[model samples]
Target: MKYRKFGKLDWQASALGFGAMRLQIIDGNHGNVDEIAVIKMMRYAIDHGVNYIDSAHGYHRGNSEIVIGKALQDGYRSKVKVATKLPCHVVNSTADFDRCLEEQMERLQTKQIDFYLLHHLNRLVWPKMVKLGIFKWADKAIADGRIAHFGFSFHDHYDLFKEIVDSYDNWTVAQIQYNFMDEEFQAGTRGLQYAYEKDLAVVIMEPLRGGRLTVPPENVAKIWEEAKIQRTPQEWGLRWVWNHPEVSVVLSGMSKMEQVVENVAFAAHSQPHNLTAEDLALIARVRDTYRAMGPIDCTGCRYCMPCPNGVEIPRIFGWYNEAVIHNSPQRLRSYYSDPNMLDKSERVENCIKCEICVEKCPQNLPIPELLDKAHAFLTAKG
Candidate 1:
C-alpha cells in the first residue's frame, strides 16, 4: 500500500483510508448490516495495509461504529487508527458533546478515538460550536485520553473553511468532500491547499463524488477510452485527488470486496504530483465533457442563492443535472427524499416561480423552467 505523510502527526498513513459510511446492507435495510461481508472486506483492507478507518456517529444510522467495534476485535484494533465524528447538527447543549463522544466510544469499543472530527461543519454551525465551548471540550477530551487528535470535517464555503482553520491552532486534521468534480465546490482546491499550508492533514471524503464519477455517461467514458493510458473511472477520480501533495489520505467507502481490492491496487501506485501533463489534460477533457452533457451551465457559484422563497435553486439544479447527465435517478431520488439530506424549504416544491432567480443567474439558465424540469426529473419514479 502507498502511504503519505499525514501532516505533522508524524504517522505514515496509507494513501487510501477506509470510509465506513456506505456499508452494504441486507434487503436495502440500513439497520440490517451484512456483518460477515463487512468484516471480511474490512479485515482484508487492514491486512493489505489500510491503517485508517473513518466512521461517524450517524453513518449507517450509528451501526457503522458498532460494526467497527466488532471488526476491530481479535487484536485487529491495534493495526489501524479509528476516526469518527461528533454529530454537531444534533448538538443542543454543551453536554451533548461529551454525551455523544462517550456514546461513540462505547459504540467503537475504544477508549481513545485516534482522530475525532466535528461533523458537517458549516458557516452556520462554527460559531454555535465555539459558543458551546467546543474547543474546551476537545481540550478536555485530549487531556482525558478519550480523543488523540482534534479535527473537523468541513462542508462550507472556502472562506468559512479558512476561517475555521484559522480559528483553532490545535486542529491536527480536517476532512472535506473533495473529488474530480468538486474542485470548486465546498472547501475546494483552494481550501485543500490552505489547510496543508497551515500544516493540517487534509483527509478527503467523496473522492468519487459519492460514487457519481465511477459511472459516467458514454460521452465522458469515450474520452477515457480514447486516452493513451487506460484506467477505471474510479481510478481516474481517486488519482485526481491523490495527485495533489496537499492531500493526506483519501477516504473511500468501500462496499464490496472487489472495490477494496481495486482501490488498494490503485493506492499502491498513487504518488503526489505524479500525474503527467497528458494525464491532467485527459482528466480536464473528461470533466469538460461531463459538464457539457449537463443541461444547465450552472457552475454552482451560488450567485443565485438565498432564493427569496427559501428555494435552494442551485442545489436543486445540481441534483437535477446529476440525474440527467450521470443517469443516477435512484440515488438522487433517495438523496432528495431524505429530509435529513435536505430541508423541505430547499426542495423544488418550495420554488414559487418568482422569476427573481432567473434575473440574477449569470448562466441565465431560465431558472424557473429548469427548476420545474429538476422537480419533474427527480420526482419521477423509476
Candidate 2:
C-alpha cells in the first residue's frame, strides 16, 4: 500500500480508499447488504493497507453505514479512518444537523467521525447551509469531539467548487467525481488543481465513472489493444486518475473480492505523472471511441440548467448513453430505481420541448429529442 499526506494532518492515508457504496448484496437487493461478504471485503482491504473507508448516510438507503459498522468489529475499527457525510438535502433546521449526525454516529457505532462532509453541495444547498448556521454546528461538533475534520463532497460547477473551497479556512478535504471520461465534468481538473493549491486534500469518487469505464464498448476495447502495456480495463481507468499528482486518494466501490485484489495491486505501484505521451494518446483514443457512439455532446456544463420543466438533461443523457454503449438494459432500469435519482418532476419524461435549454447549450444538442430518445430507451428496457 502506498500512503499520501492527508491534508495537514499528522497521519498518512492509503492511496486506495474503500468506498462502501457498492458492497456486495444478496439477491441484487441494494438494501439487503450481505453482511458476511462486506465484512470479508473490508477486512481484506484493511489487512492489505486500505486505511480510509468512506460511507454516507444515504448510501444504499443507509444500510451501507450499518454494514460498515458491522464490518469494523473485532478490532478492525482501529485500523482505519472512517469518513461519512451529512445529508444536507434533508437539513431543515440547525437542530436537524445534530439529529442527522447523531443518527450517523449510531449507525456507524462510532463516537468521532474521522471525516464528515456536507454531502452533495451545489449552488442551491450551499446558501441554505449558511442560512441554517451549518458552520456553527460543524464547529460545535469539532469542539465536542464528534467530528475530526469538516469538508464537503462537491457536484457543482468549477466556480461553485472554488467558492465552496474558499468559504472556509479549515476545509481539510473535498471529494469529487473524477475518471478518465469525466476530466471536464463536475469539479474537473481545474477544480482539483484549485483545491490542491489551497492545500486541501482531494479525495476522488467515481474514479471509474460509476463502473462504466471498467466495462467499455468494443470500440474502446480496440484502443486498449493498441496500448503497448497489457492492463485490465479497471487498471486503465484507475491509473488515469492516479496519474494526477493533485489526487490524494482514489476511492473504488468494490463489490467483489477480485476487484479489491486488482485495485490494491494497481495502487501499490501507481505514481503521479507516470503516464507517458503514448499512454495519454491511448486514453484519448478511448474517449474518441465513446464520443463517436454518443448522440448528445453535452459536456454537463449546466448552463442550460434550471429547466422550466425540471429535467436533469445531462444526467438523463448520460444514463442513456451508458445503456446504449454497454447494451445493459438491466443496469439502465436499475438507474431509474435508484433512490437518489431526482424526483419525477425533474425526470426526463417531464420535458415540455420548451427549446429554451437548446439556446444555452454549448453543444447545441437537440435537448428535447435526446430526452425523448432516453425516455424511449429506459421505457423499453423496463
Candidate 3:
C-alpha cells in the first residue's frame, strides 16, 4: 500500500483507509452485522497494508466499532491507526462529550484513539457544539492521551467549512464527501484545497458517491469504454480522488472480500497526477453524461436554501436526481421515505408554493412544480 504525508504530522497514512460503515450485514438488517465476515474483511485489508481503519459511533447501528475491535485483536491492533468519530448529534450537554467518548473507547476496546473526529458537523450542530464547549473537551481528551489527534467530518457549505478550519488551528484532519459528480457538493474541491492549504490532512469520504458511480448508466458506461486504457468505474472514481496530491487518504466502506482485494490492488499503484490528459477527458465525459441523466438542473449550490416552509429544496432534488440518474428509483424511494435519512419536516411535502425558492433559484427551476413531482415519485408505493 502507498503511504502519504498526513498534513503537518510526521506520520504517514495509508492511501486507502478501511471505512467500516458498510460492513457485511445479515438479512439486510443495519444493526445485525455479520461479525465473522466483517472481521475477516477488515483483517484482510490490514494484512494487505491498509493501516487506517475508520469507524463511527453510529455506523452499522453502533456494531461497526465492536467488529473492528474484534478484528484488531490477535496482535492486529498494533499494525494500524484506528480512527472513529464521536456521535455529535446525541451530545446534549458538555458532560455528554466524555460520556460518548468513554462509550466509544469501550466499544473499540482501545484506550487511545489514533484519530478522533467530531462526526457529521453541519449548520445546526456546529453552533451547538461550540456552545457546549467541544474544543475545551477535545483539548482535555488530547492532553490526557485518550485522543492522539483531533479532526472533524463535514456536511455543510464551503464557507462554513472555511470558518470551521479557521476557527481551530490545532485541527489535524478534515474529512469531506468528494467525487467527480460532487465537485460542487458539500465541502467540494474548493474545501478540499483550502483544508490542504491550511496543513490539515484531507481524508475523502464517498469517493465513489456511495457506490452510485460504481454502477454507471449506459451512456456513462460507454464513455468509460471509449478510453483506450480501460478501467472500471470504481477505479476511475477512486483514482480521480487519489490523483489530487492534497488528499491523504480515500476511504472505501468495503462490504465484501472481493472489494477489499480489488481496492487494495488499486491502492498499490495509486499516485497523484497519474491520469493522462485523455484519461481525464474521458472521465469528464462520464461525469457530464451522468449529470445529463438527472431531470433536475439543480447544482446543489444552496442558493435556494432557507425555504420559508422548512423544505430542503436542494436535498430533495438531490434524492430525486440520484434516483433517476442511477436507475435506482425503488431503493432511493425507500431512502427518501426513511425519516432517519431525511426528516419528514424537511421533505418536499412541506412545500407551500411560496415561490420564495423560485425567486432565489439561479437555475430558475419551477421550485413548487418540481417539489410536487419529487414528492409523488419519492413517495410512490412499489
Candidate 4:
C-alpha cells in the first residue's frame, strides 16, 4: 500500500483508509451487519496494507463500531490505526463529552484512539463547543494519552471551516465530504487547501458523493467510456480526488469484498496530478450530466440560513436532492425519519410560509415551495 505523511506526524497513513460506514450487510439492511463477511473484508484489507480504519458513534446506529471491534479481534487490532468520532451534537456539557468518549472507547475495545474527531460540526454546534470549552477537554485528553491527536469532521460552509481550523493550533486533521461533483460545496477545495496551508491533514469522506459518482447514470457512464483510458466508475471517482496533492487519504465505505479489492488496487497505483488534460475533461462532462438531473440547485452556500423557524434549510435540501438525483426515495425517507433530524425541533411542516429563506437565497430558489414538496413526499412515505 502507498503511504502518505499524516500532517506533521511522524507516522505515515495508508493512502486508502477503510471507511466502515458501508461494511458488508445482510440483504442491504443497515442494522443487520454480516459479521463474518465484514471480518473477511477487514482481514483482506489489512493483509493488503490498509492500516487506517474509520468508524463513528452514530453510524448504523452505533453497530458499526461494535462490528469493527469484533473484526479487530484475534490479533488484528495491532495491524491498523483506528479513527472514530465523538458525537458533538449530543454534547450539552463537558461531562457529556467524557461520557460519549468513554462509551466509544468501550465499544471499539481499544484503549487509545489514534485519531479522534468531533463528529459533524456545523454552525449550530460550533458555538456550543466554544461555550463549553471543548478545546480544553481535547487538550486534556491528548495530554492524558486517551486520544493521540485531535481534529474534527466538518459539514458547514467554507467560512465556518476556516474559523474552526484556526480556532486551535493543535488540530491535526479535518475530514470533509468531497468529490468531483461537490468541489464548491462544504469546504470543497478551498477548505482543504486552507487546512493544508495550516499543516492540518485533510482526510476526505464521501469520495463518491455517498455512492452517487460510483453508480453513474447512463450519460455519465458513456462519458467514462469515452475517456480513452480504461477505468471503472469507482476507480475514476477515487482517482479524481487522489489527483489532488492536498488530499491525504480518500476514504471509501466499501460494503463488498470486490469493492475493497478494487479500491486498494487503485490507491496503490494512484499518484498526484497523474490525470491528463483529457481525463479531466471527461470527468467534467460526467459531472455536468449528473448535475443536469439533480433536483435542487442549492449550492449549499448557506446564504439562506439561520432560518427564523430554526429549520436546517441546506440539510433538508440536501436530503431531498439526494433522493431525486439517486432515485432512492426510500433512503431519503429514512433520513427524514432519523431521530437526529428533529434535533432543531423544526420539520418540513414547520416552515409556516415565512419566506425568510427565499429572500436570502443566492440561487433564488423557491424555498417555501420546495419545503412543501419535501414535506408532502417524506410524510407520505412515512
Candidate 5:
C-alpha cells in the first residue's frame, strides 16, 4: 500500500481508504448488511494496508458503523485511523450535535474519532451548522478527547466550498466528490486544489461516480479497447483522481472481496502524475464519448446557474442526460422525483421561460425546449 502526506499531519495515510457506505447486503436491502461478508472484506482491506476506514452516521442505515466496529475488534482498531461524519442534516439543535456524535462513537465502539467531518455541508447546511455553534462544539469535543481532528465533506458550489475552508483554521481535511466525469461538478478540481493550497488534506469521494463509471457504455468501452495499456473502468476512474498530487486519499466503497482485492492492487501502483499523455488523452476521449451519447451537451460548468425562476437548469439536464445515456431512466427519474434529492421548486416545471438562463448558457442550448423534453422524459411513467 502506498502512503501519502495527509495535509500537515505527521502521519501518512494509505492511498486507498475504505468507505463503509456500500457494504455488501442481503436480499438487496440497504439496511440488512451481510455482517460476516462485510467484516471479511473490511479486514481484508485493513490487512492489505488500508489504514483509513471512513463511515457515517447514516451509511447503510446506521449499520455501517456497527459492522466497522465489529471489524476493528481483535486488536484491529490500533491499525487504522477511523473517520466518521456528524450528520448535519439531522441536527436540529446544538444539543443534536452532541447527541449524534455520542451515538456514532458508541456505534463505532471508539472513544476518539480520528477524523470527524461535518457531513454533506452545502450552501444551506453550512450556515445552519454555524448558527448551531458547530465549531464551538467541535472545539469542546477535541479538547475533551472525543475528536482528534476536524473536517467537512462538501456537496455544493466552489464558492461555498472556499467559504467553509476559510471559515475554519484548524481543518485537517476536506472531502469532495471527484471523478473523471465530474470535473466541473460540486467542489471539482478547483476546490480540490484550493483546499490543498490551504494545507487541508483532500479526501476524494465518488472517484467512480457512485459506480456509474465502472460500467461503461458501448461507445466508451470501444474507446478503452483502443488503449494499448488496457485497464478496467474502475481502475481508470480511481487512477485519474489519484494522478493529482493534491489528493491525500481516494475512498472506494467496496462491497465485495473481489473489489477489495482489485482496489488494493490498483492502489499499490497509484502515483502522482503516473498516467502518460496518451493515457490522459484516452480517458478524455472516453469522457467525451460518454457525453456525446447523452442528448444534452451540458458540461456541468454551472455558467447558467441561479435561474431567476428557481429552476436548477444544469442539474435537470444532468439527470436527464444520465437517464438516457446510462439507460437507467427509471432509477434516474426516481432520483429526480425524490424530494430529499431535489425539491419540487427546482424541477423543470418551475421554469417560467424567462430567457434569463438562455443568455448565460455557453452551449447556446434552447433551454426551455430542452427542459420540456427533460421534464416529459424524467416524469414519464413506465
Candidate 6:
C-alpha cells in the first residue's frame, strides 16, 4: 500500500481507497450485502495498507456503511480514514443536514467523520444546498469536531464543477469521475486539474469507469497486447490515473479478494508521469477505438442546449453512448435515474417529438428519435 499527500491536510492517504459501493453481497439486490465476506475483504485490504475507505449514505442502500462499521471493530477503526457523504437530494430543510449526519454516524458506529462530503453535486442541487445553509451547518460541524474535513462528489460538467470549487474555499478534498477514456466528460481531466490548482486533494472515482475499462473491447485488448510492455487491462487503467501527480487516491469498488490483491500491488508500484510516450499513444488509440462503437456521435458541442422541455439532450446522449459502449447496464441505469437529472418532468420521456432541437443540432442528429432509443434502453431493465 503506497501513501500519497492528501491535499493540505497533514496526512498521507493510501494511494488506493476502498470504495464500499460494490462490496460482496449475498444477493444481487443493493442492500443484501454478505456481511462475513465484506468484513474479511475490508480488513484484509486494510491489513495490507489501504488506509482509506469511502462509502455513501445511498451506497448499497446504506448497508455499505453498516458493514464498514462492523469491519472497523477490534481496533481496525484507528487504522484508516473513513470517508462518507451526505444525501443531498433529500435535503428539504436546513435541519436535514444534521439529521442525516447523525444517522450516518450511528450507522457507522462512529462519533466523528474523518472526511465528509456533499453526496452528489449538480446544477439542480447546488443552489438548493446554498439556500439551505449547508456552509453554516458545515462550519458548525467542523468547529465542533463532529466532522474533520469538508468536500463534495461531483457529477456535473466542468464549468459547473469549477463554479462549485470556487464557491467554497474551505473544501479540504473532493472526488470526481476520472479514467483513461473520460478525459472530456463530466469533471474529467480539466476538472481534476482545476481542483488541484486550488490545493484540494482530488480523489478519483470510477478509475475503471464502473468496471468497464477492466475488460477492454476486442480491438482495445488487441492494442494492449501489442503495446510491447505487457500489462493487464486493470493495471493499465489504474496506472493511467496514478500517472498523474494531481490524483491523491484512486477508488475501486472491490467485490472479490483477488481484486484487492491485484490493485494493491499496482498502487505500490504506481508513479506520476511514468508512462512513456508510446504508452500514452497506445492508450489514446484504445480510447478512440472504443468510443467509435457508440451509436450516437454527439460531439457535446452544446448547440442543442436548453431542450425545449429541458430534456438535456447532450447529457442524455452521453449517458446513452456510455451504456452502449461499456455494456454497464446497472451503472448507466443508476446514472440515468439520478434525481438531480432524471425523475423530473424534463427527462427523455418528455421529449414530445419537438424538432426544435433538430434544427439547432450541429451534429444533425435526430433528437427525438435518439431520445426514444435512449429511454427504451435505459429504462428497460429498471
Each model's number of backbone clashes?
0, 0, 0, 0, 0, 0
**Largest lDDT belongs to which candidate?**
5
Q: Which stretches of candidate 3 lie over 4 Å from their true place?
A: 306-310, 329-356
Off by over 4 Å in 5: none
- Residue 178, model 3: lDDT of 93
Q: What is the lDDT for 365 in model 4? A: 95
lDDT per residue for candidate 2 within 305-360, as digits (tens), equals: 87988887877777777666666667766765554455567677688898999999
Q: For model 5, which pairs clash?
A: none
Question: After TM-score superposition, what is the CA distance of residue 201 in candidate 6 from its true location, in Å?
Answer: 0.8
TM-score of 4: 0.89
Off by over 4 Å in 2: 301-316, 328-381
**Lowest summed lDDT over 10 consecutive residues: which window, candidate 4?**
337-346
Task: State every prediction's TM-score relative to the real structure.
Answer: 0.90, 0.88, 0.93, 0.89, 0.96, 0.93
Q: Is candidate 4 or candidate 6 better by TM-score?
A: 6
Off by over 4 Å in 1: 305-311, 333-360, 376-382
| Candidate 5 lDDT tens digits, 1-382 | 9999999899999999999998899999999999999999989999999999999999999999999999999999999999999998778887888888899899999999999999988765777899988888888999999999999999877888999999988899999999988888888999999999999999999899788888987778888999898899999999999999999999999999999999999999898998999999999999888888899988877788888878878778988998887788888899778765577888887888988888988998889999999999999997
lDDT of each: 0.88, 0.86, 0.89, 0.85, 0.90, 0.88
RMSD (CA, Å), candidate 1 to true, equals 2.4
lDDT of 5: 0.90
Model 3 earns a TM-score of 0.93
Model 5: per-residue Cα lDDT at residue 277: 98
lDDT per residue for candidate 1 within 222-332, as digits (tens), equals: 889987888989998999999999898999999888999999999998899878899999999988888787877889888887789887776677777767777778988
Higher-scoring candidate on lDDT, 2 or 4: 2
| Candidate number with the higher TM-score (2 or 3) | 3
RMSD for each of the candidates = 2.4, 2.9, 2.2, 2.7, 1.5, 2.1
Residue pairs whose backbone atoms clash in candidate 2: none
lDDT of 2: 0.86
lDDT winner between 2 and 5, please give it. Answer: 5
